[model samples]
Target chain A: MERIPILRMGDFLLVTIQVDMHDELAMTLQDDLSDRISKTSARGVLIDISALDMVDSFIGRMIGTISGLSRIMDAQTVVVGMQPAVAITLVELGLTLPGVITALNVERGMSLLRERVQSE
Target chain B: MNVLRSGTQAVRIEQDVVLARQTARKLAVEAGLRLVDQTKLVTAASELARNTVVYGRGGDMDWEILEEERRKGLRLTFRDQGPGIADMKLAMTDGWTSGGGLGLGLTGAKRLVDDFSVESAPGQGTRVMICKWT
Candidate 1:
């Protein structure tokens, strides 16, 4: 099975989704991120989705689920690099992604994650 | 209206859903739709294709590029022989899903397209058709 790699970066976990993920792949990612958060004792999670052109209901739901899971697991999650087209489509699809944090790019996302983690 | 190209792709598993999105993107581009419009159509296709797999048990996505009176468009129809929707009215309602989804698949897809229609019965399978013109 294909898996999206989760990179350990100091106190944070970084996931850069570059492929057009299928449904199962998206679900697997949710599971893997949760496990990594617990094992690494990571303080934050940063997901880069610039490469993805679309965010359907499934992927949208997955993102929200990941955010919620990481939070209860004692980690903050920040999603970054959403394409403009994807943002437009996501809202039109009726997914506002409530309760999720977002940043413009990885650098900003990392800083935001750092700020949130430190302030907590 | 005239069909410039037409084809059918299976939606049996998770991967097929990706293919359906790719196919819709291609057709939308070929139809000369704007970037945002193309994204909307492809997103709608992704939603419907997934419903066909998860709810409809497996199905097919039929695509056609159309031209009429100087306007170009892309049309997609998702069909499945699996157990059909029992209450289409409730099924089409926003935030209502039988499959643990966000219930946006049907309602959201309908919002993303210019034209949309669905036909289904208890044992008669389901067919959802949507069109976008540019």
Candidate 2:
């Protein structure tokens, strides 16, 4: 079974999605991340989607679910590096990805996650 | 309209959905679609392909590159033999899903393309067609 690697950086979890993930992979990541957060007691999660070119409703829902789950688990999630075309397509697709914080890049995403974690 | 290129990809599983997106992106690029157009077409392909696998139980994505009056376009048709949709009006409505999804699959896919249409019945199968012109 293939899986997306979740890197632990201090109090945050960093996930750089570089694959064209299938539905199962997305579900696996959701379960895995929630499990990791509770086990490691992480404070924030930074997901880098810079490599992905498309984000349909399924993937969009997965991101929203992850964000909601993290909030309940006492962690913040900041999605970063969305391509301009993907953003346009996502909005046109009617998925606003509500509740999911976003940033321009990983550096800014990390800072945003840090701030959110500290403010909590 | 003339079909410059055409092929069919099976949409029987989750991985097939990803393959469908990749194929849509390649054909969209070959059709000379711009970046945003390519993304929209690929995103629409992803949504439709997943619907074929999930709601349709299994199907095929038939693709064609069309040329008409020096304009290029990509058309994709997702057909499934599974239990068909009973009500298209309710199915196309946003946030109304029978499978516990966001219910944006049908409606969202429609908004992302230049042309869209669907055909389904209670006992007959469903076929959804979408086209993006360059």
Candidate 3:
């Protein structure tokens, strides 16, 4: 997996994760992100999952959990760029994560997060 | 006419995960559950089936269709004569996964249904029961 930190237009810290949506790796990634978000106290987190073609039940649940943990740590999380098939599979598996937000692209996700941060 | 149809079947699969899911899905539908309820039932069954093959060294799933006061539902029990879970608490915790299982297997399955229970001992084997209402 490749993780890169980027600075957005509105002072939002964007972390992009590029990797296969496997179970073990996804959990590990979540752990790392959660730790980093807690330590940095970032305003928002943007996860770019565009490269992932498929997300099984386990990975989907982890994403949901990560979003919740981020909120607890005082950071909002936005999942960006999910494939259509992966989205369908997650819904079919009956895995509905309540608080996490999704976006069709990274720019939109970052925009939403920026707006959220500004409003809050 | 009987309100509920119940039966038990056992199969041994070396590493066939798809077959296990198919069997569970079929049983859930045949038991007169709604589509959404069937999805939850099958999802839970898939998790147990994978565990049976991966951690249990093989096992069987027992199921029954239940009816009461015009309400219908399905109950499934998965039993395996393999090494049982040593730490039930840790196993149920979020993000605590063994055997490379995503760690959501037990918890997610539990949330999908209306009722859930687990019985296991170190060497006595493990049994998981879950039920979903239609």
Candidate 4:
């Protein structure tokens, strides 16, 4: 199994998640990311899901949970590069994420974060 | 007239998802649905099958092929005797999840198919009916 990688980009953190994104791994990633955000005091987070081929209910919920927790930790989150098919499937499953903003690509997501940091 | 096909197999809750995906793929091919349509059916079935094993304590999936004139579709019913959901509305919320999921399973599954219905009660288990047209 490939472990999720977290990298630092200026004040923001970029977490690259590549997996099937199902039950236990999803939950663990959420908890771990939330904890890291608090500890590192990152201003923003970019979650890269471009490599994920499959996502189930549990994984969807975990992503929502992470977004919620990131807010509490005073960090903004951007979901980057979601596959079109995956996005459609998630929408059909009624998993619309309210607070988390999704970007068409990682560059756009990073740019959004830069704007956020500059405004603050 | 209804063309009924039944499959029962002993499988772990984790593996049930695989079975669901396989069944959906087979049905989609047999029905000659487009690749996009096939993917939608597979994704919906994946969510429901995960629910059967994870939340419903494992169960069975029954698929029925329906044809009317030039139209063809497939209906999948998932029956499980697990602890039922007490609150349907809350469970439908995007961020509301008992487990660590993104809580999109039920809602996402609903979006993939043309018709969807879910029935559940506390201590009574759950039944989910979904259909997709080619």
Tens-place lDDT digits, model 3, residues B14-63: 33444555666777777677655665666677677667777888888777
Query: iRMS of each prediction in angstroms?
Result: 0.6, 0.5, 6.2, 2.8
Show where candidate 3 strays beyond 4 Å. Answer: A1-120, B1-3, B14-16
How would you encode candidate 4's per-residue C-alpha lDDT over B1-134 as one tens digit per residue? 45645455432467557667776778877877776777778888888888788888888888877786777888888888889999999987665678755566787788788999999999999999988887
DockQ of candidate model 1: 0.91
Better of 2 and 4 by lDDT: 2
Q: Write the per-residue lDDT of candidate 2 for residues A45-104, one digit (tens) a residue.
A: 999999999998989999999999999999999999999999999999999998899999
Give one digit per residue, the lDDT tens place, for model 1 in B7-116: 99999997899999999998898999998999999999999999999988999999999999999999999999989999988998999988788899999999999999
Residue A60 of candidate 2: its Cα lDDT?
94
TM-score of chain A of 3: 0.84
User: Isolated chain A: TM-score per model?
Assistant: 0.99, 0.99, 0.84, 0.90
Q: Relative to the true interface, what fraction of contacts does candidate 4 keep?
A: 0.49
Report clash pairs, candidate 1.
none
Candidate 3 per-residue C-alpha lDDT over A17-111 given as tens digits, one digit per residue, 9 for 90 to 100: 56443334566677777767766668788878787644546557777888898888888889999766556545654566668899899889988
lDDT, candidate 4, A6-82, per-residue tens: 78777788988865544556766777787789889998999998886455566666677787888788888889888
| Native interface contacts kept by each candidate, as a fraction | 0.95, 1.00, 0.00, 0.49
Looking only at chain B, model 3 earns a TM-score of 0.88
- Weakest 10 consecutive residues of candidate 2 chain A by summed lDDT: A111-120
Candidate 1 per-residue lDDT, tens place, A1-120, comes to 899999999999999999999988999999999999999999999999999989999999999999999999999999999999989989989999999999999999999999999999
Structural similarity to truth (TM-score) of each candidate? 0.98, 0.98, 0.55, 0.73
